[model samples]
Target: MDITIEHLARARLITTEDREIPVSATLRYTTCDPLAVYVDFPAEAALDGEEVTWTFARSLLDQGLRAPAGHGDVQIWPCGRTRTVVEFHSPYGLALLQFQASALRRFLVCTYGVVGSGQEDMAAVVERGLSALFGGV
Candidate 1:
């Protein structure tokens, strides 16, 4: 239920007029090693439907393995990584957990590729992941 992080990562975010539109991105971070990053599409809107919620979670875990880093605003070779789950109560508005290719595959196989939760938990996951990946102020 509680996730704490104390590492500095490279990241940037921007909001557009479209609320429902999913934000695509590629991110990389160092966790013990130069961890390759992958994530699902951005999970926008409050997750109310079970199917939709799971969809976003699965996407994130699924893509965690592959490296999706880039040098521009838009991804060059876009890959569906992981959807961000936000935890406002903790700190950051949301957290985007980047799954490495091996980690993604391993998690999917080990966990049966299930991701997501109610808005509250989703937010918690997001916040925790963000804090871990990026430095929290």
Candidate 2:
């Protein structure tokens, strides 16, 4: 599996101390290690003058992304009808991220390819990913 970019969006990183920074970024993952995902933002996107990459362990992210409805330090779930929300909590601060459904669908297709149940439509792939993350919502 190759390192694939699944989605890119205009995002805002919100810190626990109430600091928010705008960014253009993408999410990437590989089949060789589906448990890990990478969030990559360019050097210019960094406020501290360094390129930033965050590797999310499957266990931690799975816990955060599937945090039992309304519980946990990190929470990820659908928002409205066409968006997903990801919130991270830490002793130092919090980070909130959101992405569009259409973009996510494209990312899934690009990363996983249009096959299996998703061959019919790219949205199906996104739906599958969301289901896995939210436990069928």
lDDT of each: 0.31, 0.58
Model 2, residue 9: distance off in Å is 2.3
| Model 2 ranges off by over 4 Å | 1-3, 14-21, 44-47, 57-74, 114-137
Cα lDDT tens digits, model 1, 33-93, are: 1112223233443233221111223334334234333322222222355332221111323
Q: After superposition, how far is residue 20 of candidate 2 from its true place, in Å?
A: 7.3
lDDT of 2 by residue, 32-82 (tens): 445556677788866566766666643444333333233455566666676
lDDT for 30 in candidate 1 is 20
In model 1, the worst 10-residue window by lDDT is 28-37
Error of 2 at 85 (Å): 1.3
Residue 90, candidate 2: C-alpha displacement in angstroms: 4.2
lDDT of 1 at 21: 32
